[model samples]
Target: MSVRQTRKYTHKFHAPTTLKTDSIFYRIFQSLPSTFFELINQPASLAQAYQFSSVEVKQLAFRIDGVFLPNTSELPIYFAEVQFQPDKKFYSRLFAEIFNYLDKTELINNWGGVVIFPNRSVDTGATERYTELLNSPRVTRIYLDELTAIAASSIGIEAVKLIIEPESTATTKAIEIVNSARQQIIDAAQQREIIQLIETILIYKLPRLSREEMGKMFGLNELKQTRFYQEVFAEGKLEGKLEGKEEGKLETIPQLLALGLSIQQIAQALGLDEQVVRQAAQPKL
Candidate 1:
């Protein structure tokens, strides 16, 4: 008789801290890429000529969080990294990835790097090897905490700052950002996207609170009355109804979930019952 053996295995789920922060930065770049150039003290107009993206170097198994590529050779390409935790080898890894990308692309234009940290304390990366590079003008480092001292009227900057705002004050800052976006952004669609971004940020920041509670905390009912929100939701609802497909409405739940909205909120937004939304949100496996 053959001997039989049994093995037990356990799995642990780890919430990705880097992914959370990176998602916020990616969304910011997607919605308002100019805010990035603004943060680096560069002309915001530069954003107009650049499109932001994330790049991966599969050969070395390296990935860059963000890259702003110029439309032409006239402008330098930008590499952006959001570092919330301390890593002794950050500069080494960053430079390696940057140079690798440059080598792979064979671009002749100059390049710049921007690193964002929550504060100086967390920027404990070893820099002895890259001292000259770090000291050069090609690299820019931003401490989010330092940004609070300057009073900026730009809605984009305000939204960026809200990410590092303390929990006690985050709600207040978010309301201000929403109101500022409403007044500053003339385009209705753009204004709504900004508001949605703000909502997404708060959802990540305050995960303990239910969506209904967040809506109340941020005075979302008042926001719903705004023309931007009304128009966007009305269009979505009309499109779904016209298709006469329940799946059309359900498809939005995943997006809302990705934005940190709870199933209850998704249900309310889609005019569906909680069970239906919950079922749709479940993993197919």
Candidate 2:
């Protein structure tokens, strides 16, 4: 029987993690460390979950997506702000929260900053307070589009391409990526994950593709017919049956042998050694 497939997300398609959006962010930070945030005391490392508090009494907090602790053995922490959208109040809220966190943490030392925008145009209407700060040596702002000229040099070209692709184009590109990755990845589990990611990115781009159509694009139907898939399922159903009877033990022996296990090896599998397996192998003797 054919299973009916359903499309996952029907509304508000934000870029999903399966699209490797977060990984793209990390790649950017890795390549342009100075542009996003200074390394501070962190020597070539990215802080995934950073913690900071604003006021001791209020307990203000900021959980930065990425942080670069000072490398020269400094207490001041450098925080990275990666913004994929054009939020007019982006800087306003960012500094307010960071300062609040500083107060709460009682962190009194040199601090560095970075703010990344998808493109130069997205840097809209910064407050005068932030304007001065943006100009400060301690803070750096990066525009991903501005760096497109260097796309060839980019380690995250796939991610950069994702930003530029239209919905239709994205689906096509995603299919190609999924196909390429499908061949490149040898591990079945990992290949499955990437295939799922491909589907997710597509669904995130176009909510209209029905799950059935999506399955066709990713070749899921073809995968279901593989011998490996059938065997795993068939074995799963027989698990309990195989565990119960003495006949089941006799039955398991030849199957194990058919699977290239020697009698001794099959004996080991059933928790019996050479002698027990040999006796089980003999009929009525």
Alpha-carbon lDDT, every model: 0.72, 0.51
Candidate 2 stretches with Cα past 4 Å from truth are: 1-58, 61-78, 84-86, 106-111, 153-157, 179-198, 216-285
Off by over 4 Å in 1: 1-19, 58-62, 217-285
Per-residue lDDT for 1-285 in model 1, tens only?
000113211211112222266667778888898999889887888899998986666665555658898989978999988777777877886787788888877678899999988889878989999999999999999998899675664778888888878778888888888888777878877877887788777766766645445444333334464343454466666445524667777776664565455677667767789999999898888
Give TM-scores for every candidate, taking all chains together and pairing residue i with residue i.
0.69, 0.48
Candidate 2 residue lDDT tens string, 12-129: 1144323434444454444334323222323322433333221222332224445555434355576666565566766776776566555666446677766656667767746677
Could you say which candidate leads in TM-score? 1
Provide the lDDT at 228 for model 1: 36
lDDT (Cα) of model 1: 0.72
Best by lDDT: 1
* RMSD vs true structure, all candidates: 11.9, 13.2
